[model samples]
Target: MKTKSLLLAALFAALTAIGGFIKIPIPYVPFTLQIAAVYLAGCLLGPKLGMLSQLVYVLVGLAGAPVFAEGGGPSYVLQPTFGYLIGFAAGAYVNGWLMQIFQFRKAATVFLANLSALFAVYLFGCSWLYIAMKWIVEKPLTIGQTLWFGFLLPVPGDLLLCAVCSILVARMLPRIHSVIRKQEVVS
Candidate 1:
């Protein structure tokens, strides 16, 4: 891997970890700016690197970095919200892939890409929440309650963050790509 790419991935992972600190605690899942950071990673780094960045974040947290909204460590995987953490990586990958297909220049395309990524996160999160809550946590919840508690409650804020991230991605992509191209030529 190029040094610059690796550095960018590390920087994004760090940003995500930092973002976890800015949290709004709720019942099942806490709202956090980490999703915005995840979006930024995808929009800035592309799919492969973006996913790598999220993986780095997860590994660091698993190593007891205390980088999650709550605490960290392998035990975190048991948490109902852990699915969201896993979703972050998938969401970033989907965001980057959609950006490649749709192109980020158009505002509508950027918005759609971000929205799609958000849905990917929700899908993984809600599914994991349902399974974990029912089997592991032994707190069985109906589908409606699961959707309400796990997904709907925080969606509005996520949508707002998506808008903000889409705008930022649209604005920054050209410059970021230009830099990468220049680096490639130099190399």
Candidate 2:
């Protein structure tokens, strides 16, 4: 069970890194479908294991794996994008927790929760970016600028990706999980 779960975590992390690699940098933040991966990890793996997946991602990157945006290692962690990286972890956990609270993994609930979790990602990323840009860059980043650069433009792209991920997961989760459960019972 543990091994299977760990394997899942690593697989998801690698997928996320792949998603991160394909991006177009906007003014406030880069646009990537990584958040879709984050949300999918949580919904599929649940909260505790979802977080472990992200931890594994961070550890892999710290170990000099190019599994993060702008590459990995201690330097990348210190980079401005680092906060957004952390936000990915937080967003995964938040998505799972919120789903558990709502107890609504139905199509409708899952859709809304996925959307909500997407916000959680951007919220953490933008807030962290604001602080980092101000302190690290020594400049005032206005709220208007932040919203425009961070939120408005990327919402559509993120929305589409999240929708695709959520729908795919929603369709596959039941069958896949059931197969695993059946194997466990047989064993």
Whose lDDT is greatest here? Answer: 1
Which pairs in model 1 have colliding backbones?
Answer: none
lDDT per residue as tens, model 1, 1-187: 9997899899999999998999888889888999898888887788999999999999999999899998999999988889888888999999889887767776567888788778988999999999999999999888998999999999988999999988887788788789879999999
Residue-level lDDT tens digits of model 2 in 1-187: 5898889898888878888789888775778867877888888887777777887887888889988867777666555556667777887887778777776556666777677677777787777777777787777578877677767877889888777877777787788779989999999
**Against the hidden reference, what TM-scores do the models get?**
0.94, 0.89
Candidate 1: segments with Cα more than 4 A from true spot:
181-187
Winner by TM-score: 1
* Per-prediction tally of clashes: 0, 0
Q: In model 2, what are the clashing residue pairs, if there are any?
A: none
Residue 1 lDDT (model 2): 54
What is residue 42's positional error in candidate 1, in angstroms? Answer: 1.1
